[model samples]
Target chain A: MDNEVLNTEPQPTEEVRVVMPLVDILDGDDGVTIYFEVPGANSKTVDIEVKNRIMTISAASSLRRDGLPVVFKRNFRLSDGADIENITAKTQDGVLTLNIPKSERAKVHKIQVQ
Target chain B: MNMLARIRNAEELLPSTLGGLHELFRSMLDQVTDLGPEWLPEGSAAGRALTVETSEKEVTVKLPLPGCESKNIDVEVIGDQLTIHAARTEVKDENDKRHYIRRERSFMDYQESVLLPVKVRGHEAKASYVDGILTVTLPRENPGSPDSHVVKVD
Candidate 1:
């Protein structure tokens, strides 16, 4: 009843325009993986950038309606130990997965006892 | 230094300086809570934007459930109410012993019911899950039926 409208009518605008997609960050032996939910976004519409140790993610969705917009964006700061040069990203089923490897010096190494 | 977790706002969480993220986070929650009254369940796996579009013939509802498998999703319609239940189980690798340091995304057990503005053919309603977006289309019960008529007065 709140959003019901006829086909000929235009989509009602929402009070809030910008939205932040939900995210999940996990750590592993190799590195860390981050997941962002931006439905309706695909490889072609997603954009990822890292500058000055700040990583920014954004995507453009095909569907637009009240309380939701066509664009999605988020930003993150890389850790000192993260290997920015080796960061990789992929978008699947509206979720963006980014993997950031640890730098060589940052990896833990066990020293042999003499 | 530890790598920061993903922040919902466009602003990155700087280690030393606590940025003025209060307003941004407040706006984010406002956008989320305004989706619908019964659109989201408390402590749901993930929050999503729900869109309802109506046409002359049918009413369509779209909800995005990322990381969900098709088998775990269930769609049911009774009368003018439509219910969607979906779950996404976490994948735990046998050899991977590493635990989640900051597990933000995992199981998505979602259950929500919405009331349709117009009567629909519950039995004939069709639903499809494509690219993480579940679209349910219900045909109107009476497409061309007039709701009101003017009586002729002599």
Candidate 2:
């Protein structure tokens, strides 16, 4: 029995970490809607800026006991034909929402035949 | 003949009380080995309260930052990845004679990182903070596929 048990040694268990992104997007006729899930994050701890057709969002979280340090980061750029001025955003219920209106030229239009 | 006699004698002289003890030991070992880490929550630590999700058309990043000012939070995107970083200091009132039994929330600086699925045009991204959440919108670049061509047959 001892020899048989020794031959059937149990395998070591693996440690797995779950890393989930905090964002969602919905496309619409006029613009696109983007959603982000940020719990305990306030407006003061976040920065939103648009420069040279680039939009940047960054924030630092408050540290707690036995908590890992915050290293959250993300970046994105706009398309050439995108309309940046009509963009709007809001945050509520630990979720961020942004509306990006399409440019006039980018909107689809039907032509009437004479 | 002497070895066979000793083996038979030991078999007949086994302790009767060890049966229950052996069963208990087996149960304990089974319970300990069956315990898994899945019982714990994901990202269940202080100072790290953010989840990021991305798609081909846009990238959304969320952060849970309570008692933080919206004006202090900053969101930026470099290349194809998005970065969210913010900092704030909490000032406790010394006059208040409030006793705390337990505290789990964090009160220090924190930073989080999110990798976008598609390449985003940084110049056109937008962000907003309404209640306590921060949402960022990044428009994807066009694949620039060629227009369909017409064919004529003779």
Q: DockQ of candidate 2?
A: 0.07
Candidate 1 per-residue lDDT over residues A36-94, each given as its tens digit: 77777788888888766656676766656443555555555555567888988988776
Show model 1 residue runs off by greater than 4 Å. Answer: A1-16, B1-47, B91-95, B146-154
What lDDT, from 0 to 1, does candidate 2 have?
A: 0.48
Q: Each model's TM-score?
A: 0.71, 0.36
lDDT of 1 at B128: 80
DockQ of each: 0.21, 0.07
Compare the candidates by DockQ and give the number of the best one: 1
- Fnat for model 1 comes to 0.27
Q: After superposition, how far is residue A99 of candidate 2 from its true place, in Å?
A: 37
lDDT of each: 0.63, 0.48
Cα error, residue A76 of model 1, in Å, equals 0.8
